[model samples]
Target: MSDGRLPTRRRTVGWIVAVIVMLLLFAIGWVMVRGFGALSELQNVRHSVAQLHKAIDERAVDRADRIAPRIAQHTELAGDLTSDPIWRGFEFVPWLGQNFTAIREIAAIAGDAVDDAVTPIVALAADVDLTTLGLSGSRIDLVPLPKLADPLSGAASALAAADARARLIDLDGTLSLIADAVGETRSMIEDAASTVGALHGAATLLPGMLGSSEPRTYVIAVQNNAELRSHGGAAAAFIQVSAAGGTISVVRAASGLDVPALTEPLELDDAVLVLYGDGPWRIPRDMTSVPDFAAAGSLIAQRWQSQFGTAVDGVIAVDIDTMRHVLTATDAVQFDAFTATSDSITTVLTNDMPQAIPDPAAQDIAFSRAAQAVLGAALSSEEPSSLLAALSDAARDDRIRIWSAHEEEQDLLAASSLGGALPHDDDHDVHVGVLLNDRTGAPLDAYAAATITTAFGVCDGTPATQIRVTWTSAVPEEVAASAVAPEGGAPGDLRTLIAIYGPQGASARGGLTTTLDRRPVVQQDITIAPGESGTATATFTGAGSSDPLTRLHHTPMLEDPEILRADIDCG
Candidate 1:
């Protein structure tokens, strides 16, 4: 009886152990199945994203609309699979649960995007003809502009929501599965959102900005970077353009030479007045010494008002490179003097204009004529996409900077790189400026190139930043001798005012030197002979900025400055 009892008890214990092991195995299998299901759903969502993007690219709105809804469906399915409290609770289960959390978060964000972004974007694509916004024709079609505002607003909302969610993603763990996908989606979404927002704001403001209610006048300052100035090159020429009721026309074109002398004594910014001496009040060159374009813009508007007895609503600064971009888009433009094509526009405008025209005064005439002809062609051009692409390229290269006097319009521009305002250092980015203000009073800067080198070190428990700017004059001696200068200035002297800006909160000190003089000083008038070079060095301490990255801000010059990053021996 004792043996029989022992055997029965042993069998019961073995059965109980077998049941517990089976339960553990089942739990593991469930989690595995749940995680895999979530991954599969995520792949479906990604597939939908790809399809939608393809539809948008092809401008197949119906396809996009169909694909858009599927994203929401797949995201919901994935969301439900992972959002179950039991599955979510597995998040603490080490390596197995990370993918679940990632899919959950991504699905949630993607769901918000589908609701706020996808439908509206499809609507935008269907309703608006993108080429019309290029201002390709003489008159802007204002009808679709208003229609775009809603979808654009929705897209922006979706992007903001997605970005907020993306920020919360644990990139080190769960998101490793779709890191590139997540990153690319976020980047593309942010960029598209910004573009849409800008377009929406512009659409809302453009009718009035273009003087839909009444006629508005604007001064288009043509900056020539041949002689590098604070804002591109000298505003060597000015074109007065007017718009009324969505129709734009070039009213008149004038060289900076013809700007009427300032009759009314004007109140000018001290920096402008100090750096650029009291010269004939020409708006084109007036801003060459100042960095803040808004200030220059105001001065330009004021000067235009003073000279022409009419107030300008805004200032648009375009450079020779921008003209070339337009020419490229239009293929080529022809005037009585010559054809302005992309291939030859830069050289013809900068190098050959004076020689071909053989008259310094008429060189401005040739330049203006070529520019006006290009403008005329663009206004009449049938290819809106090409023209818009050209303008986009120019703006990206900092060749097109603008400032509007209208508060609303300027506010819109402030959100754009084309606003031409110095960036505020709220994020404590290491800001170092190596700017050249041409004092040679000539276009000799065409031959000048700059090299800026920076290194980082720690000093007394804080980061120390050092900068050096080397200016080289590659002008041939003959070219230097023949260079044209502002009426009263010498031709051969490549005099430049080197304004060095350091990081905010950092105490800075530096000076200039030249190959001619081996000694460096705290400050000196910078003068480089033709075919020579000069250097400026500055050191900054106490910036308290921990960011190792540095950014240099300067006016876009003819020759792109060479940038070098070097490590400091922290010893």
Candidate 2:
């Protein structure tokens, strides 16, 4: 019995040892399963990363290739605008306008391409699928194992990692290319936009020059002792136009006609007439020197007033170079031909017509010989009118020639036509005054007003400030007699006064007693430093005028010109 019991006990012990071994084996198997599962999941994550990298690289390369051509085109377009001769010629004509559409289109395309390339990548990143790759949860489920583990899993993971790194490198390179391309495209667009903007600004003035119903006339009145060619003395030409009647005339003032004394009123039928001449005639460069130009212009204006009983509204002067460039650029004549013809015409006009070009023979001879020959080859047609027409046509194109002389005329024309007029008074009278002063009350200089207009409104009456005064003429028929000042001295003495007059006797006044546009004048005090300037404004309403000139006449009067002195010391 004892022996049997001992054998049984040993068997029991062996069974216990077998159970312990089985438990150890099971633990090892479980550990292996979990380790493999985690590894597989990491491999899957890496695979997704590799795929994403590849997509990013491919898209970047595609985008760069797509935008490269457009970038090149935009660069070329920008270059052409600055360098192309045809474009330069086109600038002379205002109507051709600017070519901004092409630039805008290219910008739009580049913007769109960037959007398209980035959108898909962003979407793919946001909506990546992990469930299909058996990565639904954070922990791996060991119960759902495939019959055979993917033998290529490790190899695939290694390949994926390598591919991903390569793709990232490629992506980096492609992005750099894209950045360069975009930069080039943007630079080109900006250049084109700026050029187009300038062109547009210049072209905006054409309509005013061409579309005015009034006769656009210019009077070339010589103010100097320059020689004339027609009769061998001083020469001048009065270019006149009647838009309503479709009549144009060029009159030659008789030699020895006192240019300053010829301030006679001449009838211009609803026309914009500018009196100008060839001379170093003084013109005010700015408010500081306006008086000099204004005084000189005033003399000319007085001549018109003496002759026609009304002052001229506008005045301009041109040099010999100006005339040459205008004619040359418009006709597209070669430089040599333009120089010759211009010289000849200048000689004839300066030596002969010491007064004006009133003779038909002179006009015919001048136009037929030198002028026609210079213009003939330039125009498609041989008619003198055609040459003028060609010039007009060229002015409408967007081609700006860089000739300094022509640029001056263009600036002058733009100013005269578009810039508002200076202040004036009824009876076609205008007073333009400018004062320059140091920080103290001492006056340094004074200038004639080059521009005066009611458009500037009122004076704020701030000390040391420069003020502009304008007046409009009054027409007796337009306003009631009661509104008139009774032709005597003003009714009241006021610190500030403004009077407006218009065609047909329309008039209004403003001060402490009179109101502006029915609104009482508000006076405010402002302090100015010794070297600083300030302005005071007073406005008057309820005045009527037939034209801008007439309205200026009815505006107001500046009582103390010294009060509006400019601060010169501030500079």
Candidate 3:
């Protein structure tokens, strides 16, 4: 009887084990199906969203309108597929759950972003004729701008939240491929958030500043790469522009030397004063020497008002590279005394003009002519949207710095890369700055290039680091005597004002023409003979954080400077 009972129990146990195995297999198979479907939908969402962006950028409203709905549909489907009971249950599995959780959350975030941001932004984009906003014939229709402000702001906020949620997804313990996909998703969300936020900032500020309601005066200072300043270079020319009721025109043009120095220094930030002193404040040409465009812009505005009696609402600074972009966009641009297409503008402005017209003051007038020509062409360009895109690219490269006397507008500008403000310690990354000013007082920098590198050290925590800058002067000694000597600098030699701002709270010890500087900011006056090289170093201590990301910031150089970061000196 006992043997019979034991045999029955064994058979029952076998049946129960077989049933459990089948159920487990079915659940796994169903989860796989759901995952692949969700993946397909998510892929569709990405494609639609990408196409929608391209359409909006190209101002193809009809195409964007068609693509916009597809994004929302795919996003919703992906979210639903990922959130189903079987898939959601698998998200709790101990070892492999991180990947599941990440995918589910990413789908949800995408869906929410579509609902909260993409739909409304697309609708608003359709309402605005972007070409009209792109400065058509020296005029822009500002009416659509104000209407766009709110929706763009809302979209920016939604995407910002999506960015935050995406970053929080844990990729640890996930499959390698899943982790890579999730990381890329996070990066894309982050980039979208940043870009939209900048656009929102622009929308909020541009209308009022461009004189939608009242007349406004703006000073556009064209910085020359010839004589590099901390922010870019000395303002070689000034174009005074006036705008009212969506129409704008150049009011006047002047050389940077045309504006006389201030009789008395305007107020300065203690840090700024400590570094550059009254130089940037007193000499309108030297305004950019301070590296803080806000301060530089304010002083220039004051100087222009004092000189010409027109109070500027804002100051915009552009370099030769930026103007080249503008000229490229406005293909029919014509210049006098020298031929300059976008391809030849850099040579025309920096090298050819200096050689052709040697007098510093006269050279400046010629540069001013070039600036005026580009502005005129841009204002009347047939493809103003292309001009707008070019200017936007220049801004992204930090080649354009803007300042507004209006406090509210200035606040927004200060928060962006183009503001040219020194970053504080508490900003996202550990920051180090290398500012270069050509003390040669000539367009010598156009003939030179800079190479900058930061050597990160490891202390106990966030290690203090050192920034090394080497300036190479390519000017033929003969040309230096011919070109730079006229500006009262040593013939055949390059003199430079190198300002180094270390991590905000760090102390610095330095070498090679450096004077012991105030905490975190070091200043050096270096002279490199023509066809020679000069180097300087700023060593910092106590600059590290628990989690440190080092960022090197610099003024716009004639040739885009190369930046290198290396880990060294761990001991």
| Best candidate according to lDDT | 3
Native-to-model Cα distance after best TM-score fit, residue 187 in candidate 1, in Å:
6.7
Q: List the residue pairs that clash in candidate 3.
A: 226-443, 229-233, 462-544, 462-545
Model 1's number of clashes is: 0
Give candidate 2 misplaced runs (Cα > 4 Å).
Answer: 1-212, 220-238, 242-258, 262-302, 308-316, 326-571
Ranking 1 against 3 by TM-score, winner: 3
The estimated TM-scores of all candidates read 0.73, 0.24, 0.79
lDDT order of candidates, best first?
A: 3, 1, 2
Angstrom error at residue 347, model 1: 1.6
For model 1, the stretches where C-alpha displacement exceeds 4 angstroms are 1-58, 63-119, 134-136, 154-194, 260-265, 273-283, 357-359, 428-432, 484-493, 510-525, 543-546, 568-571
Sorted on TM-score, highest at the top, how do the candidates line up? 3, 1, 2
Residue 334 local lDDT, model 1: 72
Clashing pairs in 1: none
How would you encode candidate 2's per-residue C-alpha lDDT over 221-296 as one tens digit per residue?
Answer: 3211121111111223222111112223332232122233322223221111111222212211111111123333
TM-score result, candidate 2: 0.24
Best by TM-score: 3
lDDT of model number 1: 0.68
